[model samples]
Target: MLQSLSIRDIVLIEALDLDFGAGLSVLTGETGAGKSILLDSMGLALGNRADSGLVRQGMEKAQVTATFDAPDPASKLAVYLADNDIEIEPGEPLIIKRSVKADGGSRAFINDQPCSAALLREAGNRLIEIHGQHDDRGLINPRGHRALLDTYAGSDPAKVRQAFEGWQSAKVALEQAIADQEAAEQDREFLEHSVAELSKFAPQPGEEQELALERATMMKGEKLTGDLEAIRAAFDGSNGGLASLRAAARRLDRIGEDHPLLAEALGALDRAVIEAGEAEELLNKAADALMFDPQRLDDMETRLFELRALARKHRVEPETLAKLLTDMETRLAAISDGGRSLKTLEAGLAEAKSSYIAAAEMLRLKRQKAAKALDKAVAGELKPLKLDAARFETLIEPLDELRWGGNGMDRIEFLISTNPGAPLAPLGKIASGGELSRFILALKVALAEEGGAGTIIFDEVDRGVGGAVAAAIGERLAKLSKAAQLLVVTHSPQVASKGDAHFLINKSIAGTVSRTDVAALDGEGRRQEIARMLSGADVTDEARAQADRLLEGV
Candidate 1:
C-alpha cells in the first residue's frame, strides 16, 4: 500500500507531506481547494508527463515523492524489480521520486537510484493505480481486459504459453527442414556427380606426401643410374680390389712362418680382404635399387597432379580430401532420406499445434465461465450506484488463428448499455462522464480481491450521486479497502464519512502567494468538515446531528 506522499513546490502546494494507511482515506474540501493539484503531484511522482506550469512561481523546480510498502515476494511487482536488478529488502519501502524543471523537463528515481521515466512508470504502475473521471489507461485499456479476466477467473496462462512455445519450436524446425530439402533438391545432380568421382578416386591421408617423395626419387635415379653402374663395375671381377686383396693375403701367409713381424702383416692383409668383399656386396645392392621403369614415373607424376587439381577444386588441403568426401556423401544421404525426416518434423508440428489448441480451448472455457460471473457481479453493483437501467456484459470474442497468442484465442472486452433496449457499446462510447465513473466503480467493485495494485486512487467517483447512491459507493470503496488501500477525493459528505482516515484540503492566500494545505481530521474536525459538506460553507446544528449519525453508522 502507499505509505506516504510528499510534495514540494508543486503549483499551490508549496510543501505538503501526507501519510496514508491501509483502508479508504478521503480528501474533502471546497471547490478550487487544490484537490486536482494534489492528484497531479502524485501523478508526476508516478512518472506522468511533467508540465512547467506545475512548478510554483519563482521556484526552480517541483518535486514529488511517493513511497509504498514492499510488495509480496512472489508478486508481479517484486518480480519486475528483480528483473530490473533493483534490490529491496523484505521490509524496505519502495520510494519513487520525480522532479520537474521549470523548462518542462523531468527526472525520475526509484529508491534514490536514477532511472528512466519509462522504468519509473512501470514500477509506479505496479505500486499504485489512479482512476479519474476521464481515465482511459490502466484498467480501462481494452488490451488488458483479457489478462484481467484471466486473473478474475484465477486461470493460469503458463500452460498456454508453454504449449505455444512448443508449437513455435516445432514449426521452426519443420520450416528449416523444408528449406534444406528444397535447396538439396536443386543441387541433387551436382552432389551425385561429386560423390561418384570422389568414390572412384579414393584419396587417402598422407598419400600426396608419399607420391611426391617417390616421384622425386625416381627422377633423380633416371639421371644417376649410369654413374651407379660405373661404380658397380669397379667392385665386380678379378681385377677389382677384393680379388687383388685376396692374392696379397695368400703371398703374405707363405712368409708368415719366417718372421714374427711377417705373421702380424699376414693377419692384417686377411682382415683387409674381408672388409673389401663387404664393400663390393653393398655396391651391388645400390645398383639394383637404382633400376626403375620409365612408365612408373609417368603414372606417379599424373597421380600427384590429379591430387593437386582436386584439392584446388574443393578448396581444401590434399590431406583433407578424404574427410571432405565423407561429408559430401553424408549430405547426399540426407537428401535421399529427407522425405522421412520431413514427415517426422511435420508430424511433430501437428502434435504441438494440437496441444496448443487444446490448452487455448480450455482457457477459453474458463474465461467464458468467468465472464458470466463477472457480468452478474457488475449487474448487482449497478442499481445501487444509480445505474439501475444499465446492463454490463463481458464480451468474449474469438480471435483469428493469425492473431492467437499465449493469452489464448479470445478477445475480451467490457461492454455496457446505459439504458433499456440500448445497444451495448464500449464504456467510453455509451456512458456519460458521470455514468462512466459509476461504471468504473461497478467494475472495480465486482473485481474486488482480484489482482491489482496495492493502492487505488479514485477522483470523485460519487460526483453525480448523493444520499443512498453516495453511501453505496462509499460502502463498496470500504469493502475494496479491505483487500487493498483506497484514497478517494470527494465532495460527498456520505463518502467522506466512510473513510477510516479523512483529510481536508484548504486554500489560503498569504501576502501575494496562494498556498494549498491538507489537514488530517480528528473526530470534532471530521464532524465539522462533514457538516460543512452537508450545509455548504455553513455548520448548522442539524447538519452536525446528521454528521454524527453518519459517523455512528460507520
Candidate 2:
C-alpha cells in the first residue's frame, strides 16, 4: 500500500506530504479544490508522462515521491527490481520518485537509486492501480482477463504454458531435421557412387612416395643391370681373375716345401687367392639381382598411374582419399536414418501436445466454474449500486488454433447489460460513464483478494448514483479495504463518512499565487467538512445533525 506521497512545485501544489493508512481513505472538497491536482501529483510519481506546463511558475522543476510498504518478497515488484539490478532490504519501504523539469525533461528513481522512467513505471504499477476516467488497469483490456480469471480460479496455468513450449520446441526440431534430409536427398545418388568408388580404390597413406621410388628403380633397371653384370664377370668368370688366381695358388703350394723363400711367396699368393674367391662370391650375388624384366616394370608403372589419376579425379590429396571415404559413408548412413529420426521427433511433439491439452482443459473447466461464481457475485452487487436491472457476465470462448497461446486456448471477456432486454456487450458499449464506474466497483469488490496492486484508487467511483446506491458503493469499498488499501475520491457524503481517514482538499490564494492544500481532518474538522459536502456554500444545524449521525455510526 502507498505509505506516503510528497509533492513539490507541481502545478497548484507547492509543497505537501500526506501519510496514508490501510483501509479506505476518502478525499473530499468542493469544485476546483485541487483534488485532480493531488491525483496528478501521484500519477507523476508513478511515471506518467510529464510536460513543462506541470511545473509551478518560476520553479525549476516539479517533483513527486510515492513510498509504499513493501509487497511480499515474492511479488512482481521484487522480481522487477531484481531484474533491473536494484537491491532493497526485505520489508523496507519501496520509494519511487519522479522529477519533471521546466525544459520538458524528466527523471525517475527507485529506492534512491537512479533508474529509467520505465523502471519506475514498472515498480509503480505493481504498487498502485489508478482506475480513473481511463480504465488502463481495469479488466476492460482483454489481455489481462485470462490472468485475472486464472487468479480467481486458483489454478496453475504455468504447467500448460510449459507444455506448450515443449511442444513448440519439438515442432521446430522436426522441421529442421526434415529440411536437412531434403537437402541431403538432393545428393543421395552422388554420395552412394562416390563411397563405392573410394572403397574400391582403397588408397593408403605414403603409398605415392613408395610407388614413385619403385618406378624410378624399375625404369633404369636395364642400364644398371648391364653395369653390375660386367663388374661381376670381371671377378667371377673363368676368363676373369678367379681362375688365374686358383692356378697360381696351386703352383705356389706345390713348390713351397722345396725352399723357404718360395714358401713365403706361396703364403702371400694363398692369401691373395682366398680374398679373390670371396670377391667372386659377392659378384655372383650382384649379377643375379641385376637380372630385371621390362614386363614387371610396366606393371608397376600402370599401377602408379592409376593411383595418380584417381587422386586427380577426386580432387583430394592422395593420402586424404581414405578420410574422404569414411566421411561420405557416415553422411550416407545419417541420411538413410533420417526418416526414423523424424518419426521420433513427431512422437515427442504429439506427447507434448497431449499434455498441454489435458492441462488446458482442466484449467478451462475451473475457469468456467469460477466465471459462473464471479458473474453471480457481481450480479449480487449490482442491485445495491442502483443497477438492479443490470446483467453482468464472464465470457469464455475457445480461440482459433493459430491464435492459441501460452495463456491457454480460452479468450475471456467481461460483458454487461445496463437495462432489461439490452443485449450483453463489451464494457465499452455496455453503459454510460457513471454505470461503468459502478460496474468497475462491483468487479473490484468481487475480485478483492485476487492478484493486483496493493493499493486501488477509485476516482469518483460513486459518480452517478446517490442515496442507498452511494451507501452501497461505500460499503463495498470498505469491504475491498479489508484485503488492500484504498483511496477514494468522492463528493458523496455517505462515501466520505465510511473512510477510515478523511482529507479535505482546499484551494487558497495568497496574493498573486493560488495553491492547493490537503489537510487531514480531525473531529470538528471532519464534521465541518462533511457538513460542507452535504450542503454546498453553507453548513446548517440540520446538516450537522446528519453528519453527526453519520460519524456516530462510524
Candidate 3:
C-alpha cells in the first residue's frame, strides 16, 4: 500500500507531506484547490513524464517522493528492485523519488539509488494502480481485455499456451526434417557415386608417410650401390696384389729370424695384407645391401602419387583423407536410413499436436463457463450504479486456427449494451466516460481479491455522476477498500463520508509564494469537509445532518 507522498516545489505545491493508510481515503476540497496538482505530483513520483513548467515559479526544481509497504518480503516489487541493483532496507518502505529541473532535465531514484525513469515506472506499477476518469477508461482497451478476463476467471491459461507452443515446435521440426530428406533424396545418386569412389581407393592411415620413406631409401640406394661396387673392385685389385705381398712378407720373415729390424718390416707388411682381405669382405656385404629391387621403388612412388591426387581431388590434407572417407560413409548410411526416421518424426509431431488440441479444447470450454459467470457478476453490479437498463457481457470467441501465444486460443472481450434492444459493442467503442468509470469499478469490485496487493487511486470516479448514483459509487469503493487500499479524489459528499480517512486540499499564499496545503481531518473536521462538499462554498445545518447520516451509514 502507498504509505506516504512528499512533494516539493511542484506547481502550486511548494512543500507537502501526506501520510496514507489502508482502506479507503478521500481527498476533497473546493474548486481550484490543487487536487489535480496533488495527483500529478503523485504521478511524478510514480515515474510519469515531467515538464519544467511543473516547477514552482521561483523554484529551480520540483521533486516528488512516494513510499510503499510491501505485502511480503519476496514480493515482485522487491525482486524487481534487487534485479535493478536498488537496495531496500529490511522491513523498510520502498521509497521512489523523481525530480525535474527548470531546464526539463529529470532524474528518478529508487530507495535513493539513481535509476532510469522506465525502471521506476515498472517498479511503481507493482505497488499502485491509478485510475482517473480518463485513465480508468483504459480498461476498455481490447488488448488488456483478455488478461482481465483471465484474472477474473482464475484459470491458468499458461498450460494450454505451453502445449500449443510445444506442438508448433514439433511441427516445425518435422517440416525441417521432411525438407532435408527430400533434398537428400534428390542427391542420392551423387552420394552413392562419391561413396563408391572413396571405398575403391581404400586409403590407409600413415600410408603416405610410409611410402615417402620407402621412395627416399630406394633413390639413395641407386647411388650407394655403385660406390659399394667400386670399393669391391678396388679390394680385388689386379696382378695378385694382396697374394704377392703376403708371399714376400713370409719369405722376409724366415730370413729375418736372424735380423730383428727386417723381421719388424715383414710383420708390418703381413698386417697390411690381412687388412685388405677384411676390406674386400665388407665391400661385398655392402653391395648386396644396396642391391634393392627397382620395381619396388616404382610401386612405392606410384602409391604415394595416387594418395596425393585423391587428397587434392577431395580438398583435404593427405592425413585427413582417412577421416573424410569415414564421414562420407556415415552420410551415405544416413541417407539410406532417413526415410524411416522421417516417418517416425512425422508421427511424433502428429501426436504432440493432438495433445495440444485436446488441451486447448478443454481450456476453451472452461473459459466459456468462466465468461458466463463473469458476465452475470458484472451485470449484477450495473443496476445499483444507475445502469439498470444496460447489459454487460463477457464475449468469448474461439479462434478458428490455433494461435501459438502466451495466452490460450480463445479471444475474450468485454462487450456492453447501454440501452434495451441496443446492439452490444466493444466497451471502448461505445461506452461513454461515465459508463466506462462505472464499468471499471464493477470489474475492480469483482476481482478485488484476485488483483495483486497495491494501492488503488481513483481520481473523480464520481465524474458525470451525483445524487444516489454517486452514493452507490461511494459504497462500492468503500467495499473495494475492504480488500485493497483505495484513495479517491472527489467532490462528492457521499464518497467523502465513506472514507476511513479524509484530507482537505486548500491553497494559500505565503510571502508572495503560492502553496497547496493538505490537512488530515478528525471527527468534526471530517464532518465540516463533507458538509462543504455537500453545500458547495457554504456549510448548512441540513448539509451537516446529511453528512452525519452518510458517515453513520458508512
Task: Indicate which candidate wins on lDDT.
Answer: 1
Candidate 3: tens digits of C-alpha lDDT, residues 389-454: 888888887766745454766777889999899998988667677787788888788778777548
Instruction: Note the residue pairs that clash in candidate 3.
Output: none
Candidate 3 global TM-score:
0.86
Q: TM-score for all predictions?
A: 0.92, 0.82, 0.86
Off by over 4 Å in 2: 203-323
- Model 1: per-residue lDDT, tens digit, 153-239? 999999999999999999999999999999999988988998898889999999999999888877777888888878777766888
Model 1: ten consecutive residues of lowest lDDT: 284-293
| Model 2 RMSD in angstroms | 5.9
Question: Lowest summed lDDT over 10 consecutive residues: which window, candidate 2?
Answer: 283-292
> Candidate 3, 446: how far from true, in Å?
0.6
Task: Summarize candidate 2's per-residue lDDT along 1-554 as a digit string, tens digits.
Answer: 89999999989999999999999899999889898899888888887787778999999999998888876778778987988999888888888888999988998888889998787877777778887766656566766777888898898889889988987888898889899889889879999998988788787878888878867765565768877777777776566787888888798888889999999998888888889878877766655554466787777688778877877887988777778788889889989998899899889889988988888888899999999999988999999999999999889999887877787889998989998999999886666877888888888889987858889998888886788888889899999889989999998999998999999999999999999999999989989888887887889999999999888766
Better of 2 and 3 by lDDT: 2
Best by TM-score: 1
- What's the CA error at residue 518 for candidate 1, in Å? 1.5
